[model samples]
Target: MLHYLLTLAIFFAFFAVEAWGLNLQFGLTGILDFTYITFVAIGAYFAGVAAMTPSTNGGMGGSYIFGWQLPFPLSPVIGGIAAAMLGVVVGIIGLRRLRSDYLAIVTVSVGQIVWMVIGNATPLFNGWDGIVGVPQPYNSVMNLSTNNYEWPFLGISVIVAAIIFWLVRSLTESPYGRILRAIREDENVAAALGKNVFRYRMSAFVIGAFIAGISGALQIEYIGAWNPSGWTTLETFIVWAAMLVGGRGNNRGMLLGAFLVPVLFTEATRWITIPAHPLLMEAIRGMAIGLLMVLAVRFRPQGVIPERKRVFPLTTIPGLKEDVANGHTAQG
Candidate 1:
């Protein structure tokens, strides 16, 4: 029971990271990135291959290209970089002039394309079988039982999640974040105010991809394997649901939604000892999640924790107070 709870805790942390990234893109920047999980898959595959030694013909596991035998921190970092690179490519292609809904379609297309390619390309990530036996971080030196090792790994996961949360929060509260919000609300107005709409949107997209990549790396490390089956368009929808339920444009809301949707609504379903077909059970779970999303949208469109408006005092503008005191008002 304790181990099960620990597992849920780890999932909460991972979902928090992924949901935060989605919030930055969909919630703040107004980018409908339906291909977000592709980046996660890229990260997971890269991390898995990086940690494993090169596969040979006689090897028991599947074959993969890179087996860098890298340590923990470096593997996840590389995974993040790879995901960001993919983001740059996609953002350049779709974010140039595509509207939100249109961009979403493009993302879905791109996601399917990537998924198909990865699923067929055997040499890349072992095709449908996927890569397995990914080594955990610090397991060699720790030399603890699998159960005991999870404790330290859980600590590492929490630390990484916390760091991501802090970094994302700081970015969202910064001027850059405000500009993204401005672009989200009205791009034409933001452009008229001399903001480079494309640049800001691209930055947000890439940054979000990086965070998703990190989350994927952590997930692969925990599960010790990854395949195309694990990352589908459905995963993207789950992240979107989290942002919607928690409140878009609010980091705290992302965290809360992450816990509620993924950990509570999704994971809680597993405890029910149902006597049904696996496929039927999976369908039931999906229906439950869908129902929750519909109810949330119907009742609380703004989410459980609505995003707070950023208000600045007029006095904050330089020389505005002095001009007012001198009874001098400039005309446009």
Candidate 2:
């Protein structure tokens, strides 16, 4: 039971990472990034390729580049850099030109393109079968049993999650975060006020992509595998659903939604008896999630925890109150 709980904690950590990234992109910046999971896949594959040994001893005969036998800790850093580069390209191409709806479609196409290329191109990252046998960090130093190792890893995951939460929360409260919200609320108004809307949007996109990459790297390290099958476009929506249900603009709400939807609801489905075929059951689950999303949107669009209103001090600006009072007196 303790082991099970530890495993659940690890899952929650990763889910929280994903949700937080999405919240930054869609919730705060309004990117509508349907290709978010593509970054995750890139991160996982990059980390897997980096951490795996070049010799095909445990790789199941799969071949890939950058098998420098690098340490596991460095893999996620490389993965994050790769994902950020991809985000830059995608943001320039899609975010700079297209409106939200068209940009979403283009992003979806990009995700499909990446998935197909990875699945079909056998020379890159082991193609469809994907890379395997990713090594864990510091495993040799501790030399612990597999079951026992998870306990420390769970601690590591919690630490990572907390750090990410703090960083994201801080970002959301900063001046830049206010700009993002302004752009999200009305890009025209932000632009008219001389704010570089595109720049802020791109920044948010790349930042979110970086975080997504880290999350993917952490997850793949724990699972010891990276595959195309794991990163479908639909997976992006799952994160979005969590954001919507929990509260899009609220970080704590996003965390709650992440735990409730991805960790709890998904796991709960496994125990429920379903007489239908496995595919049918999966379809039913998808439908149920869709219905839940619709219900949440209709009834609680602001999310479980609505975004907090930012309050500015009236005394911050000199003479502002006197000018307001003078105008009121003139009107009287």
Candidate 3:
């Protein structure tokens, strides 16, 4: 039970990471990135392959392209880079003048295409079986029992989450983040102000993808495998739900929603006393998620912790008010 709880805590941390990525793209930048999970899968796959050998190992026999067995952080970092490269490609094609709705459609289509390719290309990602036996970071050195190892792993998870949280929070609060918000609110206005909307959106998309990749790489390390089925479009929706339920534009809300939707609802459903087919439980979980999303949208669209309004007081800037006044006087 302790192990299970520790696992859940780790999951919460990773889910928070994913939520932050989506929030940056969709909430902050107004990007409807439905292909988000594709990047995550890419990250997981790369990280898994990087950490394994070409031969079968770790309770699952599979062969992959790369098996460098790189050290702790390098594999995940490579995964993140791979995801970001894909993001650049997708952003260039999809972020160039499409409306939000159309962009969403394109992203969905891209995700489907990628999924089909990964599932069918046996050489790539071992088809549906995926690559397994991804080594936990620094496990060889630690050489602890399974349960004992989890304690330190849990600490690592929290630290990673903190770094990502700090990075995103800082970026969102910076001037660049304000520009992203402006784009989300009114892209046309931002464009009119000489902002290169496409560049900004692409940057956000790539950065968000990189973060998603990191989360996926970490998850693969924990789970010891990566498969196409694990990264369905539904996973993307779940992240979106987390952001919405928490608060789209609020970082703290991401953590809250991550706990409620993914951690709470997901874990709680497993023990539900339903006298139905076991497979039905999975369906029920989906229904619960759908219902939660609906309720959140209909009753509390702004989320439990809505984004705080940002206000700029002109008086706060030194001499700015006087400068403006003098300019007006001179003009008059």
Which candidate should be chosen as best, given TM-score against the real structure? 1
96-203 per-residue lDDT for model 3 (tens digits): 864787778878998899899888887767888887678888888989877888888888889889999998999899989999999998999999999889889999
Off by over 4 Å in 2: 55-59, 273-276, 312-332
* Alpha carbon lDDT at 286, candidate 3: 78
Worst 10 residues of 2 by lDDT: 323-332
Q: In model 3, state the lDDT of residue 328.
A: 57
Per lDDT, the best of the predicted structures is 1
**What would the C-alpha RMSD of candidate 3 be, to one decimal place?**
3.7
lDDT string for model 2 (141-203, tens) is: 888887899988888788878988998999999998999999999999999999998899999
Model 3 quality (TM-score): 0.91
28-66: candidate 1 lDDT, tens digit per residue: 999999888998889888988998888883368878988
Which wins on lDDT, candidate 1 or candidate 3?
1
